[model samples]
Target: MAGRAGDRAPKARRIRLGNREVVTEGLELSFWADISHRCMTASWPAFIGGAALVFIVFNGFFALLYWFGDQPISNVPRGAYIDYLYFSIETLSTAGYGDMHPQSHYGHFIAAVELFTGIFSMSLMTGLIFARFSRPSARLLFADNPVISTHEGRQTLMIRLANERHNIIANATAQLWVFKSGVSKEGVPYRRFYDLPLIRSQSPALALSWTVFHVIDEASPLHGLDAAGLKAANVGLGLMVSGYDDVAAQTVHARKSYEHDQIRFGHRYVEILRVTEDGLRIDYSRFHETVEG
Candidate 1:
């Protein structure tokens, strides 16, 4: 029912980092080798369904063993496969009803093994569930596109992000890096990374939204580079933000990447902060919207 690696389906995976798609093949990963990682990353429904399937298969396997034995169970009718299956379920779950039980020595040995397996599996499942729920995660929302426009009489590249949780992130720090592909003087191809300096990279407490600005001056790596020039050079950008979350009591980090084509030249983000009758409000509906400058 399964094909070899060379048959047709090669071991390949397509991973999306930012807007870039990278294809990797020939990685022979064993499912059992990374079972814990796979289970932890799996969706709620998938994880639960897989656990249920395993439980059923385990009981079914023991049921066949009980069916082969001579008078394995007392209350089960002779030649009734379903009754043996039901008895197997009861024994494996440790829900032994007095009505059905092991009668022969062979049945007793199988039931003993099933009881041990039931206890071990239930403990493992409990640990996995606890680990999944205790994992730390961030709720940072990044704008879809980075905009370039004039700010403070200089061309500026701006990226906006918000705290979806509306909780304080203390000592939040941000970094921006630009990636460019070029040929070395020795005629070798290479991709280089350059840090882009932001106007203000640190915040005492980030509660709502923050806009980071990188002025493209003569000293800047992005200076004299238009959208077309960036694309020609195969330029890309990555942003990283990290801080201690007061609510979660842990350090959380978020990252976003933008390809050259996703960069918007001569554009600015729509204003989202406004004064309301009650108080100052931030309209996040237009957070990702930009207008031509």
Candidate 2:
């Protein structure tokens, strides 16, 4: 009689063919990868590598023992190394169900070391997992306040900046990077970005308007930039800001990102520098689903 395919011991699960480990499937893999990355985040790689090497060494040693029919070399009923390996692993993992117990002194010693290693390694892994999950994802939104403003008795293409988080990240210092694009004698677009000097850094608590004075004077390249030209000319703004937290002595967490679509220009001009002043602030929590621009 021929055996069914399911009874074929040689034909194992398909996962064995791939870079997949049976134990590290599904949620386990996700959890382990995150933990591994975090553990190795600032030198987490070395530790994880070492752990892998140790695991390999122990696994290979036991497999060889099982193949060779080695004994416990004591008054212990030495089972095959395969039994020792399985029993050791179970004991080390603290799943002591008493299905198999060490009968020899040599077997007992091996079990002790494995149990110790398991406890230490598991505690370390757990710490890494906690830190990784506790850490927040860093993402932020910042848009230049206004393009045109009243400066030195002239309507200038000024850029203003401020922190958006109302109650979060107090005393956050903000920096602005501006990129201006224009065509030279060849009429091809030329671009340059510069860090703007702020009188006082961005602190959410300040509630002060920080202005980047781009003097669009007669001699300035920005002077001839009409509404359409200004749009066509293309100017980009970037902000990088950080602040010290006295309470935490370290920043609890932080997030920042640059986006241009947030800067909106309407055909109707409101003579206001700050969006909050003009009641045009962005809520950012929800979308209206129908945005004109």
Candidate 3:
């Protein structure tokens, strides 16, 4: 009876990006089953470390093979593991200095194998490095929290962002989405997504700062949502910005999400722009700062 009950139990879902939950019903394979994708998507340190480890391990394996062979390498000190290891490195890198050459048939076979492996490994590493370096990324800085404040005599939801690189992003576009738990008319619980219409979603040129606003009017999805109501509904907001980076000559994208607790009611962003004697100035220290509305 216990086994049967366990089998009937529903699996827990995970929320990713706003309130999007992944349904795992009937799923057989885990996402981690693919190692190549993981390596490609892993951090820089991890990828580089893995590459170094592979190089060391491959060289060590070849060195052991040479050490076990019978007088295979010429001019290598007898029974000297270090000499064998150096020979292995030279063979694997195709950097034969001609000082130490393979003499026996066994030595030539091992050298050929190591050389082939070296070429393949080097090509794979070069492709991965190129892919990682060529990938396009954006450096947009989002405010720590979203604020609800008065804008144009109406309450509005606002999120601020700044270009950390201070480079022009041409035809930059932004979108705001709201996610909340809701009950259907049939009393079934489900997550809902609402596209919040922003007053200005596109900027011709985003060089410094941009503030996006969604007015909370009668037609707005958050028309009557107060702080408590938002919290109770497990509200989340997702913001996505994409633009053509003139400097990079590529399309760059950025995303940010704010949970219910990170949404501030009746607050306004602190002023960050100022005119200085030298030129215009932007104080990033106050980028995430806010004041009571």
Best by lDDT: 1
Model 1, range 1-293, lDDT digits (tens) per residue?
Answer: 77766686656899777778989896777899999999999999999999999999999999899888898889776648888888878887788887988888998999999989988998999999999888777789999999999999999999999999999999999999999999999999999999999999999999999999999999988889997899988999999999999988999899999999989999999999989899998999999999999
Per-residue lDDT value at 88 in model 1: 79
lDDT comparing candidate 1 with the true structure: 0.92
Give the alpha carbon lDDT tens digit for every residue of 1-293 in model 2.
77786763342333321122343222223445575564545455676686677666765564354334345423224545556666555665678767566555665666677678778877976787677555543233333234454545665543443334333455666565655776788887787866655445555542333334445466555456555655565655555645544433445433232323334332112223436757765443321111221
lDDT pick, better of 2 and 3: 3
Q: What ranges in model 2 sit over 4 Å off?
A: 1-88, 134-139, 143-166, 177-194, 204-238, 244-282, 285-293
**lDDT (10s digit) by residue, model 3, range 104-142:** 999999999999999999888898899889989999999
C-alpha lDDT (0 to 100) for residue 129 of candidate 3: 91
Give, for candidate 2, the lowest lDDT window spanning 10 residues.
284-293
- Candidate 3 all-Cα RMSD: 3.8
Using TM-score as the measure, name the better of candidate 1 and candidate 3.
1
Model 2 residue 20 CA deviation in Å: 32
Steric overlap count per candidate: 0, 5, 0
Residue 91's lDDT in candidate 2: 62
Top TM-score prediction, candidate number: 1
TM-scores of the models, in the given order? 0.88, 0.44, 0.88
